[model samples]
Target: MSRRRVQTLPRASDDTVIPDPEQRHLLWARGYLYAREPSEPPHPWWRSHELGGRTLHFDPRLELSVARHGETFVAVLGIAVDLSEWLTGLGDIAEMLLDHRLRSRSAMIRALDRVCGRYIVIDGRGEHAWIQGDASCSRPVYYSTTADAYASHAHLLAAVTGSPRHPRFPDPNGLGKRTYAMPGNCTPWRDVRVLTPNTDLCLTTGEISRFFPRSRIEHRDPLLIIDHLGPLLERQLELLTREHRLLISLTAGLDSRTTLALSRSVADRVEYFCYEFPEVREGRSPEKQQDSEISRQLAERVGVTFHTVPMPYRYPEEPLLSVTRANATLFSHPALGLSHLTSGLDDRLHIRSSHFEVARRWFRRHGATQIPVDGKEMARLLTEYHGNEAPFVEEFDRFYALTDFESTEDLCDQHDLFYWEHRAGTWVPHFLAESDVAYENYTIVNARHIYEWLMSAPHRLRSNAAVQRGLITRYWPEAMEFPINGQMKEHFPAQVACAPDRASSRNWSMSGLAASLKQFLRGNSASRHFR
Candidate 1:
């Protein structure tokens, strides 16, 4: 199917617009809408369909599919892959799921999370309903209680409800070297709130609560998890390549390398590119230079086509910036202004590295072994970790008060969940929404099943990048021959010593590996450098 932006949509002012006014009347570049008892379409240009008590509105640029069975119905907007049927697409998955006896909205949401892809699922029986987005919330869902509606962008709800901006976030136009995303599930509007990942929203009651981590995370063998992830990533990539031309972002980081390794089987079919900004091109950014250079060298070695695209930082127009401030909290990201560079590649799906940091202990404090006792401590950690100049402690405290983490205290590390739900879920998706004006994006690591495997692996393996290294070796060991982040694998004695040997990964027992790792950590001088 051909995808193109619909620029014919009506527009008023920047404050009145939702996402990208140039795209469509939808929330973002391609967004969905859920309004209860709407007299007409949310916008004159959007196509509206009634689903029981609610009306679903979306632009023709978006993918919308619905399936009904008996009194229950399932509608999915955006792309999704059925895990049970790896080759099946979202439309088939929706119809296939209707055959199953999903007893409640909770059960339906759980099943939808298992389906790997970026999208939002809307399901309900009769007048009662629920809404949730993909794992890691690649497609975000925001709700306004005053408007009694659900949408892709928070600004859309605010504009519809005429909700005044929250006093705390008065200046959305502020930009600096470092800026903070709106803490927790709070939004810029007093009446609107963002839906955190792994949480479900009830349309009828307007209640939000966690539905994941239903049970404690069990420690699993790293090799088993690696084995499971290797095939899943490859199949997902293969499925994507067959349907759409892919432009996978390449870099000198382990995350992007892991993505590259997974795409080895489909390398010939995929196009690779690295963003070459003016800073890197002018030798001002050594790190970005390494990213572009290494990616180019690796692609040349693998005999795949690669391009170094110029990504000059151009300030967005006042009108675009105003609408962006309304839709997203972190407006300082370069992607917000670089849409002009990527908008021409509308036919290719941009794949990038996101949602992989949860396994890397991203939020862990150095030399601190104990977990933070409560939300206040967590807020303090965020302040220090993210270096926020704004007062996030109060927002975090409020968020902690509303969330029920006590129910999941023992399930997994609270810090990891924070990264998954708060960091990646909130930050990454908002950036994606902002960049949606350019080209659609996807990440293979967006699957909840992959996250489960990553989260359940032994801590030592998960934190040290051994799990990722092992997965890469499983698919394409040759890809690792290149240096990662300017450091060769052999130079990092800790990684070389602790990395699971791919040949015998399956033969080693978890307890045996854990014992060896403990001994290695105690004796190795480089252990201090490892996180």
Candidate 2:
């Protein structure tokens, strides 16, 4: 099960291709070379080959096709669905191409239109090539360039090119760390670059050209937007239900609660899971008890089997290594604790509202700029309430300074899409940042597909804003009604806020400093129990 053995594949050529100690396999055929390391165990169902004038290989579990059409050739990597109906849909697409009823371009578009999962297509003739995918950008696809050729896959490309040892940047560790922290699923090394989702890249005469720019959904009414979402969600739930058992991570929060309710409406005997911290149970606070009670009540109302997992006070040894290896950032105390609590579930479906924050930001940017007087006054009041928390204010300001706060236009510049015809590029950077984090460790089966479909659907700025505003109103009415800004006043009310938990052996000093500073600068004071 070691990465090395799993990455080894029979070479197309007679001579053995020696892999670098750190590098995995780099197989070449046709006009391109495909390389990757076995980061995880090889799935028994996956397949790969260096044939048909092309090198197509994928690790773990993946489904792909490399076929020719007239003078052009196409390579497609698709999600392996478990349902027979879904498989039939895929077979139909393939059959269309074989029957000559759909041309290569038409077939590619048709396939994408029907595919509700993560996919990539590499099409080309001679030395020219192009790549395209659906809007979600769920999968991580990176590439790099060396003196000789361009490569993709962070670990494999870096090891093979020895670019890490170049005089300009002789430290591979530093380069690796930088690449690791990048937000997108794609990071073309130096000369190589990631292709934006909803985009197409063409390579001709050793030069890469962008054929399609990022596209955005047109604005529409809130009800219409929800009408569209309703079908996508229903279809996605139906697809996901193919699993033997469905497990949902339910919280008092609206996102998961809505998902759980919807799933229950469709699936039979769904299992629900909740996590409770010991500190909350032993707390001498009525508010904490009420919060816990609300979650318990919801689970009872759902009328499904429920399991409560108690969070441990301390994290396991080497928490950083575990998190870093998993390619995760932004480790909230509760989420980190839940990671341990839910470690036992092997085939569980984790329906969460982690994307709500991004959705809110998107809504604010598009429309919904009217912050109610109460909300605005509440923000100002809370700002004054915690004004005395200087330490927290100072810390937050420091961290905010380190962040890249450039307008969306500036971010578009980074991807060379500032002037692109479509506004799709505007959201690509954002999607890449969020999707990169979400796909870091999880193997999302149907949820990812649903996300892709949502990304492609048309929506007006107002509609997007409405979906967010409606969600907040429906789920977190208390937060909207109170609109407290300062955490000190919000959590501690009249009492002074206490220092964060810094006694844990797993505490990262830098992280603790950042957290403390965030509270100070934002005029909010609160402590996470797991910190």
Candidate 3:
């Protein structure tokens, strides 16, 4: 029952020995990839399921919960919680799928849109097949035009189709520090592309189309949104704890704090941890050091088991990097540290709050009045954060070209949709897939229902984390004892303290006029949410 003990493995003295291309390819090609044809399971560890014309070849290690009826079949690859009935797991969806009301494809999709959790569903009836990922599209479903097939990993698609690697590999040099996920539903391979979130793929015809935001994203009162989100997340955690151990990632930020607060009901079944990377210890960033310190303190006050994972000084070398690259084709230096971060942590669900960014309107530039309408403005906003890299902009242009804006442009800001469908959709899913080789993981907020609720709230409240604050206050107000993201208030001079730092009992003395003037000059008070 004690699962936190660190495991020791043999170390390679020569860290510089790079694996050959073929060996790397083999490593990348390890996971199961589904195609539109019936066939025997590819590996002994793998299993196959014939869904009409579609065949799912997946290792037994992966979760593939299937529900069947006369001619319709539905399989979910991860956890799915049905909010209406307070039901949990894939089997419930299976039973729900058997309902005559959901006999039609549109009816089934509408039902799925109401469910929450990180999962990808494959629905089949006779020869017609449709695939869709979770709300954030964190579990990516990539399709290859050249092979006329869909698989989880791009490299796996290439390996099965005998297609050559895209020139961008090793260094496509895309934006961001953690990974280089090509913008706008693009993957590392030219022939293979990611299936955008809020969209569905027709494996029968290789056609992809939008399925969510079916109506306008209506603005709701903050309390109503939080009321819905609180119980849903709490119930999900309860269901998950009943089956699997959890390793909740904590930090000084509000997102993680929200997750920690919601896990209070299931505290007995979960533990907490924070990374102490070498760079942070060496003073490259004091904020990370504060994160570790705050996380440890929170765990102590909450009476839960916690670990401080010490990371490697330099990037992990050779085999580790190779394997990471194999799974996470678009990776950066920090991904090498995943091995150390996950060491000794196995068979536990790694819960993160990264997907919560959408709730905060992550792409909304500070001091901007309107959203970016086209690819050019979108590229400028992206370049502002990522630098003026031609390649990055060009890739974004391609992503824009591939998107179905006709269906989505009217519902919400295009930037918000971009952050949802492309950035979080493509980047986070591959990161999760890469980490899967080390340990299982999922984002707590990876659900369309939750996102729809969050985005539906008033922008001012959502931007300042009114929803998260309310949830934390509702479940575990003790989490508010510390400042969020190391700051005491949402805006300077504490015009409004989002959450109190009860430990220090510190208060700001600046007047409202001063705070107001400063906020106006700053242009974008939205920046604080990301801090």
Candidate 4:
């Protein structure tokens, strides 16, 4: 890293035309859109290539891809629909989605008229950025202003501009503890902001805008939901089966079974897999072993293949593994202990059910067991973990008022927004990287339109997982023929409703939280590039 002249194309003998290398840095998230006065000649460091109908000017990243349609630009860093051929003729997102030839076009239109993917779209012509990662920002993006340029590569911007990482220069928009792992438009570092799922931002003025799909859609009758969902699910299955050598991550859970039910049409092409792990508690049976059998049975009944990969709860000692684990997750959360599962696989598309829990009233308080929904409760629920309680106390009103202002959305919608925007949205990209050793890419089936549709309908329809259970029965009643989720000896909706798990553990004492903060601050600096 040194100041040097930029190496441009074979320069004319007139060396005066070769401007000095102004600045160069990359965002940590695989791909990025770097704005340089919006009119500067293209940088010398950029390399260009064409995919689908658009062009990408980048090197040095994985999972980042971009394309262009007229003046609108589409860039994706994580999992997204392959619109390369379809988008070559990109026009209005709505019209493109409405095409009779577009696969799953109906579902796409209903789902915000967006291609299902954890991605960010930059409309160069519009001078704005759209983050379409659904409510859970399983994919994440960040941007900051340093010196004279607005940038997504925060650390590099800080470095190039001679700004301190802390002290003199600290987090201006830092996330509170509870919302840290899933922060939206907030980061621990000063001047950097996160792009939560389902939100967007302007490139020039740095003004933020958002699309609230819940307030826009109409709620048809609940029974009609089932009728409507069949085709949407069918479209998803069709898309998955046609392009992917489908690998379904199975478990003895309603989420996966619901997925299994839909995959039945393409059962011949599908393969099911689950992990078999050792028991964690004394005298406890191996839950994963039993779960493996349940998944095997479901696949057998559906007439597809099943494979159980034996996994150890603890991965063996390897120094490099720890460093990579920290960087992959950015030390935001504790390791999930899935190294054993992801370490030995080849790159293949994998699918699982995430974000399904929040779609229903799963997080809402019931009659006597309800959690409070007041300002204090909202602040504590969101910012409690921020190490020091001061930030949480200071920011609670803003958090509470934001959720409270959406008049038409139900309380459960508040719950979903918190998870979708901050928790799931920010967390999943890291989750995928931990398993990058196994798959080239992966996606959650219950992403995007599904979340919007769930939030649009009355909570009662989805409460008790009525829609989920009803959908399962409608599609594959026999899969529920066996006990699931430790609900033994009954054929009733196997993954029936259960009480919510305990709320998050108490926030750390100030000193302890501070220590954790210091640890995270030092995290990325130690790890070498592993992916």
Clashes of each: 0, 20, 0, 15
The TM-scores of all predictions, comma-separated, are 0.84, 0.52, 0.82, 0.65
458, model 4: CA deviation in Å? 3.7
Ranking by TM-score: 1, 3, 4, 2
RMSD (Cα, Å) for all candidates, in order, is 6.4, 15.9, 8.6, 15.4
What digit string (tens of lDDT, one per residue) describes model 1 on residues 107-126? Answer: 56566656887788777667
lDDT of 2: 0.36
Winning candidate number (TM-score): 1
Maximum-lDDT candidate: 1
TM-score of model number 2: 0.52
lDDT of 2 by residue, 1-531 (tens): 211111122212212234333212211101122433322212222244542333444442233554554545555554423222354133343333333322555445444544544445566554456555443333433344433222223333454554442332232234332221222222223333344444444443333333222232233333333434544544555665564345666665545544553454454556666666666767864554554666666666545677766665434345433432222222224234334324565434444333332222332242322232122222222233322233323322321222121223221221111112111222222222222211211122223223333333222322223343332322222222221121111221111123222122112244444453345324423222110
* Candidate 3 lDDT over residue span 1-531, tens digit each: 312111111111112223354434224322456776455554444556665576777645555666666556677765667777766656666567545224577777777766776667887776777888878776668788776577777767766776665555424444345233565556667677788887888877777777778888878755567657877887888887876778888889998999998988888789888877787878887888888888888899878888877776544566666666657766544453355345777567778778787878776644233444555555555555444366556766766666665457788766777777766887676667656654556676776777888887667666677778767765766777777888853332224344354222122233543464356436545422222
Candidate 4 regions exceeding 4 Å error are: 1-114, 126-135, 145-185, 214-218, 278-289, 313-319, 330-345, 366-375, 383-388, 393-412, 440-448, 488-531
Candidate 4 local lDDT, 1-531, one digit each (tens): 322111112211212223233211211223333444332223344444432222333322233443443434444443455332322112333333323213342243244433555444443333433333433555445556442333333443443344444432143224433444422234445555455555555555555555455444555444345545655664666665665567778899878877776666677777777766555223257775677778878777767788866655444345434533432434422222344234344334667676676666543532212244443444445544333255444444443343342442543355556556545665555655444323434443444555665555455445546456546655666666666686742211223212121111112134543443244324423211111
Point out the higher-scoring one by TM-score: 2 or 3: 3
lDDT of each: 0.68, 0.36, 0.66, 0.46
Instruction: Looking at model 2, report the run of 10 residues with the lowest lDDT sum.
Output: 487-496
TM-score of 4: 0.65
